[model samples]
Target chain A: MEILIYLTQQFINGIQLGAVYALIALGYTMVYGVLRMINFAHGDIFMLGAFISYYGITKFNLPFPILILSTSLLTAVIAILIEKIAYKPLRNAPKISLLITAVGVSLFLEYTLSLNAFFTPNYIGFPRPFEIRSYDIGMFSINNIHLIIFSVTIISLALLYLLIYKSKYGIAMRAASHDLEITRLMGIRTDNIISFTFGIGGALAGIGGLLYSMAYPQINVFMGIMPGIKSFIAAVLGGIGIIHGAVLGGFIIGISEVFVSAFLSSTYRDGVIFIILFIFLLFRPNGIFGKNIEKV
Target chain B: MRFFLELRKLIFLALFIYLIIKLVIFSGLPTDYMIQITLYSFIIVLSSLGLNVIYGFTGQFSLGHAAFYGIGAYTSAYLSKVLEIESYYGLIPVIFLAGIFTAFIAYIIGGPILRLKDDFLAIATLGFGILVRVILDNSDRISEVLGGSRGFVGINKITNLELSFFITVFFIIITKNLIDSRFGLFWRAIKNDELAASSIGVNTFIAKLIAFIYGCFLAGIAGGLYAHLYTFLHPSNFDILKSIDFLIIVIIGGMGSISGTIIAGLFWVFFIEGLRIILPSEILEYRWVLIPIILILIMMIRPYGLMVKKEGY
Candidate 1:
């Protein structure tokens, strides 16, 4: 019974972690769907989101809902600007060039934020918006933060699904991903669609950043790198351009990471996750849901 | 007749050697700092040159070059410490052995990873790089002297200006010769188009594997030199940022141009170190901020690279 409770607790913890990964992975997948390029800066955007919310709370003393909304919007705008300045010029260049530029953008965000005037390089304790409370149900204990994270993720995913599947902009986005030139010829502004994709992706990562910091209660300039890379792996694992795949990949990665750290030594946690990626890639190079396209 | 015809080339080579010897060994520089920087520049050039072979020539994008470098450093450091080799002559063979060992490891990992294309290849190599770092972080569990995270100290600083200079020059010449050979043709073909290269019986996979291994071998050699140069080894020294630094050097230097690699390698080292001297300590961190902006601007202005023409060298 004790073992069962412990396992259940760990599973719940995994799901909470998975929720954050899914949020971040959404940004990577959505951007890749349209741009066909990995936005390496997305992770840094997530970090920015965390820092923004930190200031929003500590400085402005805004309530939770407004704080979340403002941070997400601001991050989305920053991301759109980033796409315009850093990415748009290189649209016709080689894919490798785009990748390098993305890396440059990432470094720019990280170091610029690291300046002492901005957020110092040192780790800062994240300010929680509300008091934490825990409840027990049948040998399981759950915290308020966990519940909030779960509800927020579900609500956001539902809204995202509606935005992508039902809205006209979403239709244009799908069209753009399918064939950008054709979509452009059909009178849809492909550039705006691409920018919108980056915006929405940035907003999701912002929410992810908030939830992640709340869970861990620590914020640092370099915090986004690990989670960002892991979420990217999640996006890849689910199939680079697939939406559902990102969510599935997130759960798998999050659960596996949690379980490994819990059962094995925590030191092997990162190593095991990478090993899983390697072995999985060896078997299914395109990822679980990724379709193989032949290059002529 | 052949000697007479190549007399100018021989003379230029002699002059180059003389310049390096003078700059590295005999120069009464303001400090040992200048000499160290020169030697470090050679090490960076050698490693970045290796990256030029993989990404520049063969068109494989690896984000894990530093992992192989760390491997070489750790391997050499451990071997030398265990053997108690105090002399520079004794360390030379160990350095080669380290490079060979790194190549052997690359050969093992390259078989599966080289099969991946573009972004997938990048991520896989990145995964391998991170995995290596994790292993290094916990290496002391395997052996305390390995010094997992605190850092591997007590290393002998035997890498002199002359040793680094000669090794770098030798490898540059060797790399040049390799580029001029038939394998260079294979590498160029593979880089241009793998499908077409394979159609023409280029054995693209084997060619890529060879480039990957050889590139990693160079990185290993550079790492061995680096271990002895600083007399310390830390996991952070071989992290992803260091790998990106090599990438930046390769891109700025022009992917396939050897001379460009050398010039850009020197420029990159000097640029950062020069910034340290120019910028006040209070604003030293701004250099990192400035560098990325320059990188983005460079990519925007000259996507193919600063030194290379559109048709490639």
Candidate 2:
């Protein structure tokens, strides 16, 4: 009975972690779907989201709804600007050039934020938006923070599904992802669609960042790197361009990480994640839902 | 007679070496610091050259070059300490052995990883890099001398200006000769288009594997030199950021250009170290900000790199 309760508690913890990863993974997948390029800076945007929230709470002391809206909007705008300034000129360049530029932008964000005036290179304790309260359910207990994470993830996922499936912009986004040049020839304004993709992706990462800091309660400039790479792996594991695959990959990664840290030594946690990635890459490079496209 | 036939090229190389020795060693310009920078520049040149082979010539994007470097450093450091080598002469053989060991490890991992393409290959190599770092962080559990996160110290300082200079020049010559060989042709073909190269019966996989192994071997040699030069090894020194630094060197130098690699490697080292002398301690962190901005701007302005023509190789 004790073991069962422990397992359930770990399971809930995994789900909460998975929720944040899924949010980040969605951004990665959507960007890859349209651009076919990994937005390495996406993770830094998530970090920025966390910082913005931290400042919003400590500096402005804004209401919860206003804080969330402003953080998402600010991140979305910054992402669009990044796409315009850094990525737009190199649209026709080689893929490697794009990758390098993304890495550069990522570094730029990290270091610029690390400046003494902005935020020192040290880790800062994240301010919680609300008080935490735990409620007992039979033999197990659950926290309100967990409930917040679950509800937020579900709401975001449902809204994203609606935005992608039911909206005209979503249809255009799908069309853009299918073939950018062809969709452009059909007068779809691919630039806007691409910008929109980055915006939505950045906004999602922002929300994920906010929720992640709430769970972990520590924010640092380099915090985004690990989760970013892990979420990217999640996106790749679920099939690079697939939406649902990212969610599935995120949950699997989150659960496996939790279980490994719980059972094995915590030092092996990162090693095990990469090992899982290697196994998956070896057996199913295209991911579970991905179609094998032979490049001629 | 064959040497006579190459008299002009040989004379130019000797003159270049003489100039470097004169400018750095006997010019009365603070021998210790100058020699240190010169030796470090050679180390960077060798490692960047290795990356140039993989990414520049063979078109393989590896984000794990530093892992091989770290492996070589740790392996050689451990071997030397364990064997209790007293003299620098004894360290020479250990360095080569370290390079060979790194190549062996590369050969093992390259077989499976080389099968992956583009971004998949990048991620796989990155995974390996991170895995190596994690193991290195816990390496104290394996042995007492192989310090974990705290760092590895007390290694012999065997690397000198003469040794580093000679080894660097030798490897540079070897790299140049290799680039002019049949294998170099195979690498170029594979880089241009693997499918086309394979369709022409070029054995693209074997060619890529060779490039990957050789590149890693060079990285190992550089790492060995680095271990003796600094006499200290830290896990953070071999992280993803260091790998990216190599990538930046290769890209800025122009892929597949040996002279460019050498020049850019020296420039990169001097530029960063020069900043130490020029900038105030309070604002030193801004260099990181400036570097990335320059990188992004360079990509925008000259995507093919500074050395390569717009038409590209």
Candidate 3:
């Protein structure tokens, strides 16, 4: 009975962890779906979101609700600006050049933030805004933070689903992803759609960052690197261009990570994640939902 | 015409050797910081050229060269320390074996990994690099000699200015010859268009695999040399950032240009070390703020690199 409870608790923890990854993975998949490029800087953007929100709450003393809206909106604008300034000119360049530029942008964001006066190079404790409370049901226990994470993830995902399916803008995004040139020929402004896609992706990453801080309650310059890589892996595992696949892949990774740490040595946690990525790349390069396009 | 070109090349080689011998005499005997810097630059040239072959000529993106570098370092360190191999002369053979072992490992993994195209391949290799770091960090469970996070210490410092300089020159000549050969044409073709190359009856995968292995072999040799020179092995030295450093050297040197790689490697090492003298103590940590900007500017202004005009044989 005790073992079952422990297993159930770990499962819940995994779900909570997976929810954050899924949020970040959504941004990754959405951007790749439209641009066919990995925004290597996305994770650092997520870190910026959390840091901004942290400052707002602690320094400016903003409410939690206000913090979420402002952080998401701010991050969306920043993401659009990044696309315009850093990635726009490289659109016609070779794919490798674009990839290198993305890496450059990622490094720029990371090291720039680490410079003194921007943010300290040290880890800062994230003061929890709310009272700590736990609710126990039968043999398992859950926290208020866990509840918030679940509620926010489900609501955001539902809104994303509606935005992608029920809205005209979403339809335009889908069209743009399918064929940018054709969509432009059909009178839809592709540049706007591309920027909008980046905005949405950035907003989702911001939310992911906020939730992550709430759960872990700590922030650092490098907090985004591992999660960003893992979420990208999640994005790949689910099939890079597929939205739902990203979510599935994120949960699978989160759960597997928890299990590995719980059953095996915690030292193997990172190695296992990397190994999964390697195996997937070897056997199924296109991922679970991605279609393989053979070139002539 | 060919005879005159060969004579010119022979003269250039003679001048190069004379210059190196002069430098080695002035700085090599003293073994001071300047000599140490030059020796380290040679090691960088070897590794950067290795990366140049894989990414530049073969057009296969590998973000994991540092992993092979670490593998070579650890392997050599292990052979010298744990196996307790005697004889100073034996160290040369041990270094060769370590490099070969790293190449063999690269060859094995290259088959499956080379199948992925472009960005996918980049991420896969990046993952493999991280995996190597993690394994190196936690390898103490398997053996105590690895020293885990503390790093392996007390290895012999067998790499000196003379030895490293000669070895570096020998490898550069070998690579130069390889790139000038008929097989080099196939690599160039594959880089230009893999599909077209395959249609022309070239085994694209096998050719790429050979380039990858050879490049990794050079990196392994560099790593072995580095381990002995520092007489220490740390897992952190071979992380993703180190891999990026090698990539930057190749890119700055202009891909596929041997002379460019050499020049850029020397410039990069001296420039970075020079920063120590130029930058203030408080801003030392912030010195890297300019690197990414420089990289971006380079990509924007000269995507083909500084020596792009001399790319082909």
Candidate 4:
């Protein structure tokens, strides 16, 4: 019974971890669905959001709810601006050009933040705005932060689902994802749809970053890279173009990662994730929900 | 007229080689900073050439070229350092062994991976590169010689200007010859249209596998050269960023152009080093900031890069 409780506790931790990944992976999936580009800098945007929130908490003395709202909005605007500046002009250009630009943007974001004038490369301990409290059920203890993360993730995902499914913008987005040229010919401004996609994606990623920092509490220039890559892996595993699949993929990766570290050496955590990515790419390149289509 | 053109080209080549030799000798010693830059540039050119073949010529879009390079470096480092092979003559075989070993590994991995088209292939390779780095960082369980994250050190400093120059020239010639051969035609055909090439009876899979292995082999050779030149090995040195650096050289130099790779490699190294010398210490860190801007602007202005395509005389 004690072992069962420990395992259950680990499972909840995995879900909490997966919540953050699911949030980030949603952005990746949505953007990929519309643009067919990876947006390699998405992770850096998450890092930027966390840093922005850090300033809000430490410098401005903003409350937790206000910090979350402002950071999401700010990151959303920045991501939309990046899309307009860096990606919009290359819509008709070669795919490789867009990919390279994304990489450039990623490097620009990382190094710029690491600049002495900016966030700097040093790690800053995030000031927790909330009191620490835990509730025990049976033999397992759960933190208030983990509960908050889970609840926030579910609520945000539900809102996103409604926005994507029930709203006119969602229809336009789905149509755009299916065939951009066709949708444009059908009198939809693809440019706006693309921008909207980026906005929502960035907002979700910002929330993810905020929650992640709340859990880990350490902010640095490169904090987003590993999480970003892992979330991308999650997006790929669930299916690049499928929204719900990304969430599923996220939970699976998160649980497996936690279990691997728990049972095996912590060193193998990243290696195992990569191996899982490889396996999925080899056996099911289309992912769990994606359909195999010949891109070439 | 064609014979005269060939003769003229040969004369120019000879003159260029003679000029390089004179410069190397006139520098007084191989240890000079200028010679050091030349040697490092040669290694960059050598490795970028491998990337050019897979990404530029074959259109395989591998993002893990640095992982293969790390493999070669560690292999050579282990053989020479742990096995105590000090003689340059003995090191020659070890270098070839490193290249062969990397090629074999690429050949094995490339079989299943090369099936995926452009973007998927890229992500897979990226993951592979990350996996290599992670394993290298945590390799103490396998052997303490790897030094894990602390880095492996004390390898022989065997690389010099002369050796690097010869190897660079030799690889350039070999690659040029390969591109001019029937194999090059097949690779271009596949790059242009893989389905069409396959329909035309081209063994596209085998052809791609061969290109990947051959490219990785050259990267391995460059890694061996780099390992000896630096006389140290660190997992950090062979990360995804280093892979991106190699790709930048290939892309900025103009993919599929050998002369372009050579020029870009030299230009990139010297430009960074020159920036360090010209800028004050306070502003020197800003060079990195400028580099990404340059990369983005270059892509916007010339998406195909400087040379545009395989240039002609």
Candidate 5:
């Protein structure tokens, strides 16, 4: 009975954790959807966002909600600037060129974070905003903070779904994704759409980072790399460019990691994920919900 | 003309051998630091050149080459430590065996894993790297010999600048010859256009596998030398960041260009060593910060890298 309750609690935390991954995965999916290039720096940007939130809450004494909102907006602007300065010029280059730039940017961000005094050179605990503790039922338990994160994530994803599918701007964005050159020729301002996509993705990732710090509370300069790559795995696992698929992949990854770590050994968690990735690529190259392209 | 080229090669070989032996024999002008720098730079060049075959020329992004490096390093280190062998005599078989073993492992992963494109391959390889580290970290049996987290404490150190320089030169010759062959052209074609190459009856999968295996073999060779050079082998030294360090050397030096790897590898060596002199010991934690910033700037300014384009390119 105690085991059952513990499993249930772990499951809830896993779902809430998946929500955070889904947010970060959206950034990877968005950039990939448009440019077909994996922005390796997205993980570093997520890390940077957490540091920003940490500063806002501690140094500036800002409230949790206010800090998260401002940090998300700031991250959006910074992401857009990174795209323009580093990635935009080499859009026509081979994919490798752009990848190298992404690595460069990722490295640069880590260095900057290391230099900051507040962040220091080592790992430090982050500030959790709410005083909310866990609420346990007969066979399940969850923190009020976790519930808040879950609600915000669900509502945000719902709005995102509506915006992407129902709105005219969404149509334009899809058109651009299909054929950027043709879309530009047809008088659609593709750059604006690209910027907007980055903005939305960055804001989501920033919020995810903030929520993550609130949960884990231990922030370091290099904390984003592993999670960033994992979320990118989530994006790939769910089929890239499928927004809801990102959420689905995130949950699958989260739950499977918990089960694997619990059942097997915690050390084998990543090995199992990579093995699944290899197996999945063999069977379904286009991913779960991804459309296949017929080459002429 | 080809005869003249062969003659030039012979002359270079003779001079290199003479220089190394003379340094080892006399000219006692503090060769300790020089030996370390030269050996490390040589190892960097060797591995980076090999990686260029897979990444630069073949257009595959593999982040797990360092796993093979660690595998080889640990293997050679184990043999030397356990068997108490020296590099002077029977270590030849051990080095060759270790390299082949590393190649086999690389081949196994490259078969199925190379099918992944871009980020997928990157993540998978990164995972493999971590797996290597984890296994090395947790195993108590091998940990005593491999030093687990504490690292291999004492090993016979026979690596010197003379041996390193000669071995590196030998590797450069081998690589240059290999890259000039039919296999090299096939790899270059795959890099240019996989679809077209496949249409033309080029077996890209085999070619990629070959590149991966060969790259891993050279990484093993470097690792074998590195284990002895440092005299303290550990899992922590051969991490993902070390993989990135090799990648940076190749990229900075013009990937697919042999001279480029040599030059950039040397530069990387000198650059880090120079930093040690300039910076105080207290602020060494922040020293790694410069690497990333420099990497970014270089990517922006010269993505193709510092190599001059030859007529062949």
Candidate 6:
């Protein structure tokens, strides 16, 4: 019973952490869906978003909710600008070129943030308003922040679902994902849709960034690189093109990683996650929530 | 017809002599730092050649190639240090042996992961790279000889500019020949269209395996030389960032282009190191900013890289 309870608690923590991954993974899927290119820099963008929001709340003395909102917008604008400058010109270039450019952007952001005196290499401190508390139920217990991460993630995910599916922008986005040419033919401005997708994706990732700062507190400029790599795996696990698949993939990866570390040596944890990804890729390339394999 | 005919055979003969003199007789550059930079650049070129085989020729975007490099460094470094009593094949044979050993490891890991395509494969490969590093960090004996956190140390240095450069050129010629051959053609075709190539009697799987194995062998060879040159080997030596640095090289050079790889390797190594030399201490930590920005600009301008289309590849 105790083991089960322990497992359950670990599982919940996994889900909460997974939510963070899910948010990051969503950006990857969204970009991939529209452009058929992996935005390798997206992870670093999330990293920067976290720091930017940290500053907004701390140095600038902005309210918590407003900080989150502004951070997303700021991240979105930067993403849009980056797309306009770097990716847009290479629209017709070979896939390898774009992949390389993504690396370039990633490196640029990582080092740029590192250079920022305010955003020093030392860990950025966040003022946490949420009370650190815990709750124990039948076979499981979790802290207040975990609860907050869990609830906020659920709410954010729900909101994203509604926005992606219910809004007119959502319909256009889906159409664009399916067939950009036809979508453009049907009087939809795909350029705008693509930028909008980048915007929304960047905004959501910003929230993930802010939430992560609150939970973990330890961050460096290069922090986004690992999580970015991990979330990208989660995105692939969930299916690269599907939005919901990104979410499911995130949770599965997150839970599996924590539990694998809990049971096995932490050394093998990444190896195990990679093994799982490899197996899935070999057997079921579509991923947990993937509908179909989209061609590049 | 006669000139073309004679040219082909002469090219090979000249290449054969070049390899002989380059490997045996040529005493490398005079300056040690020059030798270090040259050697480092050569290794990058060699490893990038390996990467080009799997990634460029095979059309697989593998981000975990550093693991193979690490494997090569550690495997040969350990053998050289421990087996020094027997003196076993000296430094010369260990180069080829290290290549063979790393090939085996690559064969094992690359098989399952090769099935993955695009982004999923990349991240999985990244995970694999990190896994290799973490495992290296934990092992005791590997730490003792190969040096875990402290890194493998106390190896005698045999690498110099001449040795490293000649070896790099030799590897490039070999890689070029492989890419030019039917085997190379098959890899390229698979990259162009996997299913279509498969339908046309190309055993996509086998071709990928062959490219991966050979590519890994080259990487391992480079790692062996790297371990010898630096006389140090640590988990940090072959981290994901190191992999990314190589990625930056190949990308900036122009993927799959041999000359591009060579040019990019030099430009990248010297440029990064050069920036460090020129920049003040206050800005030293942030020097990476310049590289990435330059890379992004280069990609923006010449999407295929500084070179145009790759020759034969």
Q: Give model 4's DockQ, 2 decimals.
A: 0.69
Count of residue pairs whose backbone atoms collide, per candidate: 0, 0, 0, 0, 0, 3
After superposition, the stretches of candidate 2 with alpha carbons farther than 4 Å from their true spots are A292-296, B1-28, B311-313
DockQ of each: 0.68, 0.65, 0.64, 0.69, 0.45, 0.53
By descending lDDT, how would the candidates be arranged? 1, 2, 4, 3, 6, 5
Q: Which residue runs of candidate 1 sit more than 4 Å off their true CA positions?
A: A292-296, B1-27
* Model 5 per-residue lDDT at A64: 60
Writing each residue's lDDT as its tens digit, candidate 6 over B32-113 gives: 5654765687788899888877876678887888989998988888778777722323875887788999999888887887
Distance from true location, Cα of B245 in model 1, Å: 0.3
lDDT at residue B149 of model 3 (Cα atoms): 86
Per-residue CA lDDT of candidate 2, range B88-205, in tens? 7888899899999999999999998899877677888989999999999999999989999899999988898766777877788788778878999999999888899999999999
Going through the candidates in order, the fraction of native interface contacts each one reproduces equals 0.69, 0.64, 0.64, 0.58, 0.42, 0.66
Model 5 lDDT at residue B143? 45
Off by over 4 Å in 4: A292-296, B1-34, B309-313
Find the 10 residues in a row with the least total lDDT in model 2 chain B.
Answer: B2-11
- Evaluated on the second chain alone, the candidates' TM-scores are 0.94, 0.94, 0.91, 0.90, 0.90, 0.86
lDDT of 5 by residue, B164-253 (tens): 666667777777777878888888888778889999999988998898888889898888888878888777787888888888888888
- RMSD after Cα superposition, model 5: 2.6
Q: Candidate 4, after superposition: displacement of residue B96 in Å?
A: 0.7
Docking class of 4: medium
TM accuracy, model 4: 0.95
lDDT of each: 0.89, 0.89, 0.86, 0.87, 0.78, 0.79
Q: Is candidate 2 or candidate 6 better by DockQ?
A: 2
Per residue, candidate 2 scores C-alpha lDDT tens digits across A1-296 of 99999999989999999888999999999988898888889999999999999999999998877888889899999999999999999999877788889999999999888888889899999989999999999999999999999998899899999999999999999998888899999999999999999999899899899999999999999999989989989988898878999999998889888988888888888899999888888888878678863320
* Clashing residue pairs in candidate 6 (N, C-alpha, C atoms within 3 angstroms): A133-A144, B28-B162, B146-B152
**Weakest 10 consecutive residues, lDDT, candidate 1 chain A?**
A287-296
